[model samples]
Target: MSEAPALPPVRRVGQRSTLAYGFGAAAYGVKDFGFSTFLLLFYNQVLGLPAAQVGFAIMCALILDAFIDPLIGFLSDNTRSRWGRRHPWMYAAALPIAAGWLLLWNPPELSQDAMLVWVFATSVLVRTAISAYEVPSQALTPELSADYDERTRLTAYRYLFGWAGGMVTLFVTYTWLMAGPDGQPDQLNRANYAGFALFGAAAMLLAIFTSAIGTHGEIKRLPRPEIVTKPLGTHFRELWATIRNRAFLILMLAGLCYYSAQGISFALATYLYVHVWQFDTAAFGTLALSLFLGVSGAFVIAPRVANRVGKPVAAMVFMFSAAALLATPYALRLAGLFPAPGDRVMLPLLLTLFAFNTGCGVSATMLGASMMADVVEDSEAKTGRRSEGVFFSGAFFIQKCCSGLGIFAASLILHFAGFPKGAKPGTVGVEAIDRLTLYFILAYLALGWAAALIYRFFPFGRDEHAARVAALAKGEAG
Candidate 1:
């Protein structure tokens, strides 16, 4: 092959690009938090669907989403368009994502089975819409900033925006949308949920548009990645190559474990707070505030932490801390050292734990994502092809599978624990609550610890990334 044309000089990403790119995370927050924090609660607890059924429906959607993820990633990577690979999909997805989310929350009166069908249909639609935007958006991150620490910093800005959006949603939900209907459980009020769904969907539209258009100016300057063609054989070749890449596989597996474990915790947090600890709406809002503070602070400080200790060590430290802190409440409660359910200090203590764990968790999350970006460099070094979209899609695919299974398992556990649906706060029996706590702690510890160990084996760090970039610059790799 003729020598490749001289590559354009790569400029470091600036403040305007970082802010515009980072603003996209607000969509993630609104969509992710709404689905995670409230979907099961709304479908099963409030709307009288079985927990298992709701979980099953959503699980199916995630599975469906996982299948399409890689295809979209591949398409985006090879796409040649004026609007660029990522933004066309990003812009096209905005209105549909909002519509899908809104439809999910507005199901008409129906039998349990009918509701299950509606749930499955809408859930699939919304998740697909998300992947359409999110897979492309995430793929853009590695392209946005070439510096390792700069990527971390840009991601930190992303997390700050995302967590800010999620926090605001929680505050609004608890303060306004959580009003208990007369003769109804606080979570069961349909009107309240409509309002929450509307806000989330609306915010998603605005944020996606802002990011898609905001970043439009840079797409031409972004690498015009060499395209690959020739159908199935080429795909299989690339797939085999991806599988053989050790760093990519490790990052994929560890992310799967961590996110799956997190799914279980998020799915059940409401039950723990309301039935086990007997917290009211205001207290629930306080928990949201704690999470906001923790994640925001982590986003602010995690890049510096990684710079000092390196990304792998920083990842292990933060992830392990999160796991340990998350296990504390259950350990203390089981040991009979925790405050009684109605104790004045109980909420304060729980909020403190939440803040610490959330901070560590978000910190770990930031470093891990940056680590994956480094994998893109390693991948290019080895394969001489840039496939950020496929790599990121694989990450999302793992996350979707793990998260789906986790949600399904959580519902099964709830049923086995005999958790009451739509029950008043503080009404669940101590035995059931104990069992729920045990399940949570077991999952969190086993998965989180294993993931931490796996991350320790990750081969690429700042030095490795820098070396790879240097080779690419000298045309030793491309």
Candidate 2:
């Protein structure tokens, strides 16, 4: 009874413009590391909260994030705005994140219980506001370009920028935030307030400006669809169908496992390096530098590797390689062979494993983003609607929810393993350290294998995506 809107032309997005959006996408990771990497340490070390209480606080905040993300996606999809659905929210999130980052870092004078409440409440508000922007920001990708190779390029660029942001945060946090003025490493130092707050604020502003400038003409204003104006129930039903799509479902599962391992591993890093390896706080920077380089190198090389071998094969190979390498630390430690506590053996181990796993991680990032785009096309084919918001919402759901689960798991595991907050030395036992190391190794192995299996079920690799694009050219949605 209603005419379907004419399909928008698949524009060729150039490297510069795409990279700009990628920078914006990556800037979000600044906030990510802010929360995941430093927040627990902040509460436990600076605020004097215990490990169990810190873990409990994080879980509560994550639960809030889990419930709010989908609702934000649903609202963002239906929003009618002249500045565009995503950008308006993107700009709005900047201030809240800045304020929240400041608040999380410098809590007002309050009891530990009151401090927990403040952190939990503000974290929920900050992350929720961020999702409001991020879900829609990602939704813009499919709308920006539909070419198969173009999507991969965009992902690569974004991954690089995101990795850059993460690395910057890591260096500053580990080096300056935790160091005393005498250039000595002091785990208790919090005077690096200027450095942390400045970067967070800078990233937030840079992202807003980049999104506004980079995507000015890239995103064409489409006539608002009557179908999109339907009731909330209609949107929920459509979102349900999108979730049920097999390719998306599998990817979501894989993301949950892979990021869970990643999250847990990151949370455990300060402890592992200090107590287990007996390295100073500065070693965290060295290890992070190696990890960042490894992952960065992988992102750079992934496009060519995916082009030569199939994306799935490349992804599978890298995933397994990462799993093997991640275990090297544990293997060496268990064998009573690690460098003495202060010898920086962890640096060499990190470098070796990171070299291989970095490439693997790069391949995974490329494959994962492209896979989601393909699924979006496939869903459009079946449903006869261009629902990029819903599509990316599902993608965001998988990625964030899984990473949140990972962080959640890490919090619980650390508490159970007796890993004390602030590395309150000798409070946690050697038994706990052994168990934690084993947990890290086994968890990464399972996550890597599970992600590979999910890729197997996803039929939208390079060739398939090309075919799908060709079909779209011939006036068929599939």
> What tens-digit string does per-residue lDDT give for candidate 1 at 1-478?
2222232233467678778888888997887777777788888888888999899998888767767888888888877777767888898889889999999999989888899999999988887888888889988788876688877887788878888888888777776677554422276677887888889898888888888888887776666766646778888688678657898888887888788888888788777777777767667677778989898789877999999999998888888888999999888998899998779888888889989999998898888888877787788788887778888888877766666677787898898887888877667788888888888898888888888887888886888788778788798885
lDDT of 2: 0.69
Give the least accurate 10-residue stretch of model 1, judged by summed lDDT.
1-10
List lDDT for all candidates, in order. Answer: 0.81, 0.69
What residue pairs clash in candidate 2, if any at all?
A: 260-406, 278-341, 294-358
Residue 215 of model 2, lDDT score: 73
lDDT of 2 by residue, 86-178 (tens): 667777776776776666667678888898898788777767766777787777666666766667677777777777777777777768666
lDDT leader: 1
Query: Pick by TM-score: which candidate is best?
Result: 1
Q: Which residue pairs in candidate 1 have backbone atoms (N, alpha carbon, C) closer than 3 angstroms, thus clashing?
A: none
TM-score of 2: 0.90
- Predicted candidate 2, C-alpha RMSD: 3.3
TM-scores for candidates 1 onward, in order? 0.95, 0.90
